[model samples]
Target chain A: MIDVGGTEGGVRLRAPRHRVARRAVLWWSCQAASRVVVLLAAVGFGAWWSPFPNRALVIALIVLGVLGIGYVTVMPWWRYRVHRWETTESAVYTAAGWLSREWRVAPMSRIQTVDTARGPLQRALGLSSVTVTTASAAGPLTIDGLERDVAADLAERLTRTTQATPGDAT
Target chain B: MNEFPPEEATAAPTPPPGPFEDWQRLDPKAVVASTALVVAPMFPIVAIMAVSDDGSTRTLTTAGVLLGVVVLTLVGSWLRWYFTRFRVTAERFELREGNISRSFRSIPRERVRSVDLTAPVVHRLLGISVVKIGTGQKAGSEGELKLDAISTARAEELRRLLLRPRAGTTPESATPPVADSAEETGTELARMRPTWYLYSTLTASLLLFTWAAVGSALSTLSDVFRALWAADTATDWLSDTASSVWTHAPLWAVVVAAVVTVLVGGLLGALAFSVEMWWGFRLTREGDATLRVRRGLLTTRAVSLERRRLRGVELAEPMLLRLAGGSRLTAVATGLEHGETSGRSDNKALLPPAPRGVAGRIGALVLERPGTLEDGAPLRAHPRVALRRRLSRVLLPALLLASGLAVAAHQSEVVPWWSWLVPLGTAPPAVVLAWDAYRNLGHGHRDEYLVTRYGTGVKRTVLLQREGIIGWRISQSPLQRLAGLLTVSATTAAGNGYYSVRDAEAEQGLSFAESCVPGLLSPFLEKNSEFTSESVDSLDGTSHERAKKRTDHP
Candidate 1:
C-alpha cells in the first residue's frame, strides 16, 4: 500500500488506497508456471516428431524457454505492484494490468450489478475477484486477486449501495 | 403515481387500462403484404421448376409443396392479425398477442423513448407500416415493443403521442419549454442532394460491395456452365472465348482492362445503390422534438429518436471520401443502434457521404448549438511521443524483418534478391500512414460537447455531450509510462459506448478528463488541491447535490 491521499487534493492521479493481497503474487506465479509447463511439454512432443533440423530446433527451444521463464518470474510481481482498488461512499475505483495500467471509476448511481467470482486456482489460494458492471458496453470494472473475505465484503457493500441508489443505470 | 382508479388497482394486478378507448388491431392489409413478401422469392423457384420439363409427378409434388407453404403462411398471418390487439392507458400501454400461447405486455407510457415506423414496398402500397417502440434500454430488453403492419397515419399519431409529455403530467409547466415546443409539427433539417451521390463512388465500401457482387456472379455463372454439360453449344462458345481471349492480349493489357472494367462497374453500382438508398432522404425534427429520418425509394423507412436520448454526433471521413471533401454523419443517440458488428445502420445515419461542411453544420444543429466544431476550444494535439510511437509501430517491425531478409539473402543464392527490398520499399508509405494517424489524434471541448478526433484510413470525430458520460477510464502502457503518456476514455451509453483521447501527456490528460466532467475525477486526483478536490462527495449528499444530480440527468 502506497498512501498518496490524506486530506490532500491535487492534479496527479494517486494509486488506489489498498493493494492486492500479497499471496496474489504466488497465486499468479503458480498460474503462469502451469502455463509454461504445458508449453514446454507441448514443445518437447513437437520436437520429437518435428521435421526441422536439430540446430534450428535447439535455437527455437532456447528462445521459447528463456522467454517463458522470464514471463513466469516477472509478471506476477509486476502485476502485484500495479494492481490496487478502493470503494468510497459514492464510487468504486480500481487500477490494474501489468504491461498496461488501466484506472477505472464507476459512480454508485450508474452501477448496475456487483458480482464476485472464484476460479479453481483462486479457490485453492483462498482468493476471489469482484466485478462491478455499469450500463456502458465499454466493459465492467474487475478487481482481481483480492483476499476471499475482502472480496466478499466488498461485493456485499457494493450490492447494498447499488440497491440503495436510484437511477435507470443508462 | 399510479394513474388508474383505486378500485381497479385492488381488482387486478394487470388489468386493461383505458375504459374510454377501444382495443386496436393491425391493419388487415398486412396479410396481403406479408403473403407477397414471403412468396416473392419462391416465384423464380416455381417458374424454374415449371419450365424444367421434369417428370409430371415431381413437378406436381413441387407445386403441391409450394401451395401448402403459401396456405400455411396465410393461416399463420391471419391468426396473428386476429389475435394481436393493443391499447393506450393513462400510465401504461398494454398489448395482448398470440392465439396459442398468449401474452400480455404492459409498458409504462413514460418509459417510451422512440417510436419508429418502417414500410417496405408492398406494405407501402397497402399504406401500412411497422411500428417499433423503444424504451431506450440496451440489448433489446423488455423495454422494446413492435407493432407490425399498422396504418402509417396511426403510426405517426402514436409517435407523437408517445414522445410528448402527457396532458396532466405537466400541468404547472403547461406548454412545453420554449426551446422544445409541445406541438405536432415538423421542422425540415436536411434533405438529399443529387450531387452527393458522386462522393459515394469514392468510398472504399463501394469497391468491397462490387467485388463481392462480381465474385458471387462469377461463381453462379460457373455453376450454371458446369450444369450445362449436355448443352455443348453454350459450353463451347464460352470455352472458345476463354482460351483465345488471353492468347491475343498481353498480360499487362489484360490486367489493365480487368481493372478498368471493375472500377467502372463499382462506380455504377455505387451510384445506383446511393440513389435507391437515399432517393427521398429527409431529416426532420418532428412532433414532440423527435428526430425522424424518412428515406429509400422502394422501401421507405421512418426512423425516430427522442431528443432527450441523443448523446452526440459522429463525423466519419474515410480516406478517399475525405480527399473528396465528403464526410458521413451518424447520430450518437440511445435506441438507434441495431445488431452487433452491423458497421452500417441507416437508422442512425443523419446524412450520407456529403460535403464535410454540410456534415459538420448538421451535426452542430443536432447538438442544438450554433457553434462550429472548434468554436471556442481548439482540439489539443497529443504529445510528440505519440507520433514517435506510431512511427515505431511500423518502422521497427519493418526494419527488423528487412534486416532478417537481407541476412538470409547474403547467406543463400536461393533467396530472391528483391525480397530484402520489399520491406524497405513499403516503409515510406507506412511512414506517411503513421504521420496521418498521428495528425488526426486530437481532443477538445466545445461548450457542452467534448470532441475527439482519431484514426487515419477513416478519421472519426465524435462530439459527445458532457452530461451523458457515466464513467471514466484512464489507461497507460509500460512504454507510455516511460514517455509520460496515457489514454483517457469517457464511457457513455451512446455511440461505441466509449470514446478515447489517446496518447496524451499524463497530467494533461488527467486535467482534461477532470475538466470534461467537473467533479467525477476531482475527488480521485491528488495534486496540490489547485485543480483537484480532496474528499469524495456522495451523490445523495444534500438538497444542493440532489438538485445538481436532477439537472445532470435531465
Candidate 2:
C-alpha cells in the first residue's frame, strides 16, 4: 500500500539485495517512543517526592517530547525500501531499498531452510517475516512485514523448489 | 598456507537404505522413570504437610497430586511420541515432525555430515538403537530427526551409509535399494580414548553443587532441631530422653558428624556419577575424515562429526588436573558458533568429555596436533611492540576515567576523585589483562591451516584452513591511535572465533589473514584453494617491506 521505492521493482540496483526494511522506520520509531515514555515515567515516579524543581523537570520532559514527536513525523520520508520476491527458472530474487538497491538471487538448490515467523503485533496485522537461508552462506535473507498468505506461499514455493532439484547448483 | 587439494567428487555418504522400520512405541517405563525423578524431590515436604498434628492422610490433596502427576506423565509421553518420525528417501534422509506446526526437512545425501548409530545399555539389551543424522547445519537445531528406538540391524546400516569414507560409489549409484544391515567391515577404525578434559570441569562444577547441598542440609537440620527443642512439651521430654541417651552413649555426636559427612560426600559423588554417565559414552574414528561420538544414557545420541568442519581444537589442563597429567580437549565445529544449533537437549554431550591421553588420540584421529603435540616455539610478545603495548594498556583506563569524570562533573554531584577511582582501580587489572592478552596472542600458519592460540586460564587454539576465513576487518580506536596500533579481526564462516593481532604487524597480518580466504566461505564459490605451506612460509621472510618498496618503483 505504501510506496517505498522509486522504481516498481524498488531499489535493487545500488545496495545489497536486502536493505533496511521500509516498515522499520514506523516500527522502530514506535518502539523508541515506547521505550522513552517508559523511561520517563519511571524517572518521574522515582523523583516524585524529591526536592528537585518541577520547572526543570518539565523543561527536560519537553525536550524529549519534541524529539519523539519529530522522529514519528519525519520517519515516513526516510530513504529505505521493501523487497518483492519473484521466482526465476533456477533462483529466487528479492529486491528492495530506495536510494540504494539490492537484488539477491538465491538458487533453488542451495536453499537450506525457509523459516516464517510472525510476532504478536505482526500477527494482529496479518503480517509475517520469512527468512530464506542458503547453505554455506553468510546470513539468511529476511523479508519482513509481508501479508500472511504471501509469506506462506513464498515459503511453500522455496520448499518445493529446494526438494525438486537436489544439488542443482545455480 | 598451502593450497588445499580439491575435494574429490564422489558419492556423498547417506543413511543405508533399509526397510521402513517403525520404532517400537516407547514403553511405559519412561513415564515411571520420569515420575520418580520429578516426584521424589518433593516427597519430604509433601509428607511433612500430610502428617499433620495427629497423622492422617489429607485425602483430597493426595488425590489431586496423584491426578496432576498422571496428567503430566501422559502429556510428556504423547509429546515424545509425536515428535519422533523418520523415513529414508532415494537421495536424502527425510524427517517430518512437530507438535504445534509440523515441519518436513530432508538433507541431500551429499549434505549429510555424518550418520551416527547409538545403542544405550537398555537399547542394546533389546537389540534396538537410535540413528542420528548430523547435517551441515549446527547440531541439535532439529529436535527429533533421530530415528529413535529402531532395531540394531537398521541402526548399523544407517551408520555405515553416513560414516564410511567415500569409495567409488557415484550419486546415481546411491539409489535406495533393498534395505538391510551393512556388511560388517573386518577392519574397525581406531577408537579414541575418552577426552578427560570434561572431567576436570565437571569436578569443579560438582564442588559448587556439593557446597550448596551441604549448606541446605545444615540449615534444614538446624530448623528441625529448633522445632523439636522449642516445643514446650517436647523440650522437657526430649531433654530427659537426651540426658539418658547421652549418659549411655557420649560418642553419639561424633558418630552423627561422621555419618553426616559420609552421607553428604556420598550424595555429592553419586550426583556427579549420574551426570557423567548421562551419555554412557563412545568414541570412534571412521577413516581419518570423521570422528564418531555416541553419548547419552536415556535419549542416546550418536554424532558423526566431519573433521573438515572443525574450526578449532581447545586442549586445556586445569591447575588441579595438571598434577594428574590430565588434559581436556574440545573439538569445535562451525555449529558451535550458533549456541542453539546443537538441537540435543543435553548441551554437554555435543562434545564428549575425555581424559588427556585419550584426547591426544582424538586429536590424532582428526588429524590435529594440539600445541602440546606440536614443536612450535613458545609465543612471546614481539619485543619491539612491548613498550607500546605497555603504554597503551595504561592509557586506556586513564582516559576512560578522565572522560567519565568529565561527563559526571557536568551533570552530577559526584566528585572527580570518585570517578578517578573507577579508572585508578581498573589500571592494575587492565595492565594484568593486557599482559595476559599479549602473552596468549599468537597466529601462525601450519601448512594449509591457519593456527592461532590465545586466552589465559581458558586458553584456546583455533586450527582452520585458510579457506575457512570468510572476511577480515581492520579497526582502530582513539586510544589505539595514540598507541600507533590497529587491530585486525578475521572472521570465518564458523562465526565468532576470530584471529586478531595488534600493534605494528597488523597491516601485514590483516593482508596475510585475508589472503588465506578461499573466496569467502559463504556462497562457497569453488575456486582453486589459493594457499600453500611454501607460500605461507614465504611471508616469514623479514624483508617484506623492503621487498615491497623496491618492487613498487621497479
lDDT (Cα, tens digit) per residue for candidate 2, span A51-155: 865776776677867876765555433433333444444444454433233334455555768999988767766667888766433435566656566567668
Give the clashing residue pairs of candidate 1, or none: A9-B529, A10-B526, A10-B527, A10-B528, A11-B527
Using TM-score as the measure, the top candidate is 1
Estimate the TM-score for candidate 1: 0.85
Candidate models: Cα lDDT each: 0.77, 0.51
How well does model 1 score by local distance difference test? Answer: 0.77
Q: How close to the true structure is residue B372 of candidate 1, measured as C-alpha lDDT?
A: 45
What is the DockQ score, from 0 to 1, of model 2? 0.04
Highest lDDT scorer: 1
- The TM-score obtained for chain B by all candidates, in the order given, is 0.84, 0.60
Per residue, candidate 1 scores C-alpha lDDT tens digits across A1-170 of 12333322235787665677778898899989999889888877788788865767667778889999999999999998878776667777888989988999888788988899999989999999999988777858998988887788778777887888887334
Best by DockQ: 1
Residues B1-554 of candidate 1: C-alpha lDDT, one tens digit per residue: 22323443323433232321346777778888898888876776666556564466866876798889899999999999888887665567778889999988988877787787888999998988988887766665465788887877667656666676566543223223442343444788899888988887677887687678778977875664454333357678888996698889898988998899878888887788778778899888865467878888888887887788888999989999999999989888766554243455677888878999888888887778885454666699998999999999999999999999989998999998779899999899999999999999999888888889999998999999998888899998889999889899998877677889999878888888888877677666776444332222222123223323433353
Fraction of true contacts reproduced, model 1?
0.42
